[model samples]
Target: MRDSEKILDSWDAYSDEHTDLDGWPHDDHAYGLRASQRDADTVGAFEPLRYGARHLLATAETQLAQLPENTVQSRWVYQLGVLHAALDRLDELHEQWLVTRDALPATANPGTADFDDALAEHHAESWSYLDDWATHGKALREINTAAHKAPSALVNAPVRRTAAQK
Candidate 1:
C-alpha cells in the first residue's frame, strides 16, 4: 500500500517540474529548444515528467485492479489515474508546441497570422492542460488528505468506529 503522503509528494514534485514547461517562452527565442532544437535540457525535463506520470498511472491501475469495484480506494485510484493522464496529455501538448515552434521561421513575426496562429494554439492548449492539471491535482489532494486522516472517513469508517467503541 503506497502511503498517501508519498503519492502526493510525487505529484507535487511533478507539478514543480511542470512549472518549467508552463513558463516556457515559446516566442522568446531565448529559451527552450528554439535556439537549439536538439537541446538536451529541454527534452530531458519533460521526459521524466511523462515517465513519472505513466508510472503513477500504472501503479494506480494495478492498485485499482487488486481492490474491489465501487469502493473508496477504487475512486481514489481512478482520480489518481485521471491526474496522471492529465500530466501525460500536458506532455503531448508540449511536444506539439515544440513542433509548431520549430516549424516557424526564426524571423517569424508574432504579428503575422502564421506565427500568431501557431503560437496562439500552443498557448491555448497549454492553458487548457494547466487547468486540467489544477483540477485533478485538487481532487487528488483532497482524497489523499482524507485518506491520511486518523478517522479514515472512507469505507473503513466502520472499522475505526468499531475499534473506537472498544
Candidate 2:
C-alpha cells in the first residue's frame, strides 16, 4: 500500500476508537468546517510542511555524513547547504504563522463567521511563505539533479598554471 494510505488507515483506526463515541457525526461534511479552518490556520497549515522539511533536512544531513571527506564533491556540499536554508526558512515561516494565529482572539472557532473571515485573511498572507518555500525546494531539486549528473563540476578543483604562466 502507498504510505499515505497506510497512514490514513492508521488514522482511521485511531479515530474510530477515540472519536466514534458520543454520537459524533460521521458524514462527509461533519469535519468540513474544522478541516477548512485548519487549512487556513497558519500554524495548522504549515505543520505538515514543517514536519516533512525536517525529515528532508535530516536525510540530506545523513547523506552528507556518509560521503567520504576527500571524495565529497562541492555540488553535494552545496545541495546540503540549500536543504539547510530551505528547512530554516520553513521553520521561520511556521513560527511566524504560529505567532499570527496566536494573536487572534479566543473566539475564532471553526463554525463562526468571524473565524471564516480571519481564515480568509490569513490564507492570503500564508501564500507568500508557501511560495518562498516552493522556490527553495525547486532550487534544491535542481541542484541535486545537477550534482547527481555531474558530481565533479567546477567548484572545488585545484587550478593549474598554463605553460605560459609556468
Candidate 3:
C-alpha cells in the first residue's frame, strides 16, 4: 500500500522534525523493512506476523508485571520488554503494510515452510534488540531453518499452539 509507505515515511519526517529520539537518531529507529522494496507477499505475510509478535510481547510484559523482580520469569519478562519495545515499531510497520492485502491466493497463513522460516527469523530478530544478542541472534537462525522443514500440513494452516502457550 503506497499509503502505508507514506505513513511510515511520515514517522521518519516526524523523527527529523524532532531531535533524535532518546539517545539514537530518528533514522536509527527507521532501519529495516524499507517500504519501496517490500513486495505484496512480504506485506501479506508480515501483517499477521508483526501483530502476533507484538501481541505476544505485550503478553509477556503483562505477565512480568505480575511477578517479583528476582525471578527468572521476571528477568525474561523485563528483558523481553526491552527487546519488544525495541522492535515494536518495525513490527507495526509490517502490520500496516500487510493489512493492505485482502485478496490473496490463500485464506490461511504459514502458506509454506519458507514463509514460516521467514517468520521465525523475524520473531527472533525482534528479540535481538535486548541484551544476549548472541542468544537471540542464534535463535533467529535456528528458528529460521526449522521453520523451513515444517510439515507440509502446516502450509495454509492456522497457527496451532498448545493451550499452555496461550
Which candidate ranks first by lDDT, i.e. highest? 2
Q: Is candidate 1 or candidate 3 better by lDDT?
A: 1
Sorting all predicted structures by TM-score, with the top scorer first, yields 1, 2, 3
> lDDT tens digits, residues 85-160, model 2?
6457656655765676677679867767766666555555554454344434444454444446544535557889
Global lDDT scores for all candidate models: 0.52, 0.53, 0.43
Q: What lDDT tens digits, residue by residue, belong to model 3 across residues 1-166?
A: 2333444456456545644556354454343333222233333434444446555555545544443344323245445645455555565644643553332336435756555445544444332232232223233333334434444444556997899998
Better of 2 and 3 by lDDT: 2
State TM-scores per candidate.
0.42, 0.39, 0.27
By lDDT, rank the candidates, best first.
2, 1, 3
Tens digit of per-residue lDDT, candidate 1, span 68-149: 3434443565667667666767778778887888889987777887886676566545544444444454444444444344
Listing every candidate in turn, what is its Cα RMSD in Å to the true structure after a full C-alpha superposition? 12.5, 11.4, 17.6
lDDT of 3 at 133: 28
Worst ten-residue run, lDDT, model 3?
128-137
Task: Assess candidate 3 and give its TM-score to the true structure.
Answer: 0.27
Best by TM-score: 1
